[model samples]
Target: MRSAVVAASLAAVALGITGPAQAAPARTSAATAAAAVTSTAGGSITRSEIIERAQYWVDQGVPYSQSAYYRDPQGRTYRTDCSGMVSMSWHLTTSATTWTLPDYSTQLGSLDDLQPGDALNNVNTHVVLFVGWTDSSHSTATIMEEARPGTNARKTTYSRSYLNSNGFKPYRYDKVVESPVTVPDKGMTNVTAVGDLSGDGVGDVIAVEAATGDLYRYNGPDYVGRSARVKIGYGWDSMSDIVGVGDITGDGVADILAVDAENGNLYRYSGPDYGGRSARVQIGTGWDSMTNLTGVGDITGDGSPDLIAVEKSTGDLYRYSGPDYAGRTARVKIGSGWNIYTSLTGIGDITGDGVADILAVDTETGNLYRYSGPNYNGGTRVQIGTGWDSMTNLTGVGDITGDRVPDLLAVKASTQDLYRYSGPSFPGGSAVQIGSGW
Candidate 1:
C-alpha cells in the first residue's frame, strides 16, 4: 500500500503542462451554405442575414424535455451524455435539432470534413465541437463543449485524428458555418516536457515508449525517431521516467535536457538537428535518487537560465547557478524527513518578491513547502493539503484565476484527482478539484 502511494504521486508530477502566443480565429469560406438559412425559390441569402438568424438561437439556452426520458434501474433519469451535451450546444448555435441522434458519423464527414462549428462524434460516446485553430497545419484544433458531469464549459485541444478515428467517424452539416476551423499548436499533451531543442524560442517535444527504450523527438512538426536508449547506473537504471526539451546554451541557442532516472544525467542539446549532442552530464552522485527536474529562469538574478532538481529519495534540492555547468552549481537541502519529498515546482516570483521561489511536495503527507529568496533554508513551510492523499508531480503552476500569483498543481493518482492550491504562503487557500475524479 505504501509503495502504491509513492507510485501514484510520482505519476502525476511527471505529466503536468501549458502554452504560447495565441492566434486569431480562422476566416469563414465562401463556398459553403449557412446552416441557419433555407432557400425557398432559388438563390442563397447574404452572410450577414444568416448570422443574424444564428444569433437569435444563441440568446436562448438550449432546452431539453426533462419530462420525456425514462429512469434507469439506478433511479437516475437519462437526460444527456457527452453527445447529448454537444447536440444541445449545437442547437443553441444553429437552432436545429435535425441531427439529434446518438450517431454523429452519419451526419459528419471524415475528420478531414471538420471545419469551425462542426460536430465530432466518437460515433458512440463522446461529442466535441471544433471552434478555432492555433497552428500552421489544420491538424491541431481547439474544442469547446460540455464533456463531463460538472464541466458544462471547458476548452482543450485535440488532433484531428483522435477527435475523429477514436470514434467510429466524424460528421459535418451541409450548410456554411460562421468561422473556419484551423488546428491548434501541436496539442499540449497531459504529458508535460515540451519545447524546441534548437533554442529557436519555439517549443519542441519528445516522447519515449515506456514498454521499449525507444526515443522520439518532435522537430518543427514531426516526431522523428532517435536512437535506442540505455540506463545510467545510480539509484535506478536508464531514463525510464524522463522529460525532453530545449534551452539556450552558452551561445544563447537551444540545448536539450534528457534527464535520466537512475543516474539523473542531463544530455545537452548539441546542434540544430534533434540528434544527441554530446554525452550526458551527470548532475549528482551518491545516494541521491533524482526524481523531478526543471529549468528555473535565472533564479540567481543572473542574465542566464538556472535550474532546480528534487531528490524523491532524499528531500534535497539543488539549484544550478547559471547557464554553464563547469562545476559551478549550488545545492540547498529543503525539507528533511523520510519520504518528505515527491515533486518540485518552479514559479518565477512565487513569493511575489520579484524573484522565483521553489515549492516542494511531501509525498507521505500532502504538505507543500516553499523556498522564498535565494536562501532556500530561510523560507517558511506550509501544509497545503491533508487527509488521505499523496501529492505527485507539481505539474502546473500559473495565475489560472488571474490573481497575479500562480497556484500549485498536483495530481492524486490513486483517486485520479487534480488538486490546485492558490498561495504564496500557507493558511494555504482552499484546494479545488479538477478533472474526472483522480
Candidate 2:
C-alpha cells in the first residue's frame, strides 16, 4: 500500500473564499488604485479567473461610478460602475460601458447558456456579473455587480427570467478562455498536487520531477491549450510524498507538506510565490511508518483540516488532527485491514457533508470506494466506482471548475492520462480526462 505519490493535502476549499459571497459596504466615493494596464495581452483570462476577479471587487466593496476608475492588483484599470466591474473582472484592456460591453462579447441565446464570469447586460440600464445558476431551470442566478444605492459592489441572487425578459442579454467575453490542460513530458515519477497555487482561482498543478529533483509549477491550462510547465525550484526528489493542504495558514494560498523518505521527517513549504517556494521548515519527525498519507479536510469538525494514513505494518488506518495548518497531531486508529488497497487519497467532501472524505482503490478488485469523514471507521464506506485501479493519486484538486464543490484529479497509471472526477459528488460523479502523456 505504501507507494510514492504526490498526494493532495490541500483542504476541500472551493476556490477558498470563492464559495461565499462577500458582504458590501454602502456606496462611497470611487476608490482610486494605481496599476491598471490596458493592453492586448491583458485581455486574456481563464473563465474561473473571471469569477475570482469579480469576487475581488465584491470583497473590496468598490463603489459604483461611471466616471471614476481604479487599478486592480493585476494592473488593470476599470470603472467602478456596472459595466466597469465587468471590464475589470474580465481584465479587458479598455473600460467599457453597458452599451459597449456587448461589443467585446458574444451574446448567448438564453439564460441557460450563462456561466460564471459571463455577464447579463442591458445597455444603458445596468449589468451584473453572472456567478452561477441558483436554480435547476437556470432562471435564478447568483451575480456580482457594482450598482447604485446603498450597496455598491455586491453579490445578488436574482431572476434571470426577469433579466432576460427585461432585455438583459447573456454575454460571454469574446476572448475568455477555458483552462488548458498539460502533463509532464517525462512521466509520473514525481510527487504532485493540484490547487490554485497561483492564486488565480483556477487550479494549477505542482510537482517535483524525481530524476532531476526539480519543482515545477504548471499554470492553469489556457483557453487555446497547453499549461505552461515552468520549473521554479530544485531538490525535491528526497520527498516521498507532497501533500497539498489548502490554505492552512489563512494566507488564501495553498500550502504543501512533504515527507522525508529517509527519516519520515515532515517539512512545510508555504504557499508558492510565483511558483517559487521558500525554504522548507521541518514540522515533525518520525513519520517514516505511514504507508500512505493524504489530506481529508476538517474531519474532526474542529474547523481545521485533518489527515488519513495507513500503517506500514498492520494496514490499520489512522487519523491525525491538527491544532493548525500542519495537523501533526497524535494519530488515532480509525480502522484496520486497509493494506489490501493499492492506494488511498483525499477526494475532498464528496459526501456533501462539509467535511473531507477518503477514496481507496481496491488492490485486487480495482474498485473505488468512498469513506466519509470523521474517523472513517465501521463499514460505512460506499462503493463509488468499479475498475478504478488504473488511477493513482486520486487526489482532490479543489473546486477548480468553480462549481462550488470539491473535485478530484487522478492519473491513469497505465496510460499516464490525467482525469477530473466531478458531479454532485464522487458517488454521483464521473471522470473526464483533462491531460495526458504524463
Q: Which candidate tops TM-score?
A: 2
Off by over 4 Å in 1: 1-237, 240-246, 250-256, 261-264, 270-291, 310-316, 327-339, 387-389, 400-403, 415-438
Cα RMSD (angstroms) for every candidate in the order listed: 16.5, 20.0
Global lDDT scores for all candidate models: 0.39, 0.60
Per-residue C-alpha lDDT of model 2 across residues 6-47, encoded as one tens digit per residue = 223343423111110122253322222322233243557776
Error of 1 at 298 (Å): 1.4
Q: Candidate 2 regions off by >4 Å? A: 1-186, 189-194, 221-227, 273-278, 323-329, 424-430
Q: What is the lDDT of residue 411 in candidate 2?
A: 60
What would you estimate as the lDDT of candidate 1? 0.39
**Deviation from native of the Cα of residue 315 in model 1, angstroms:** 5.0
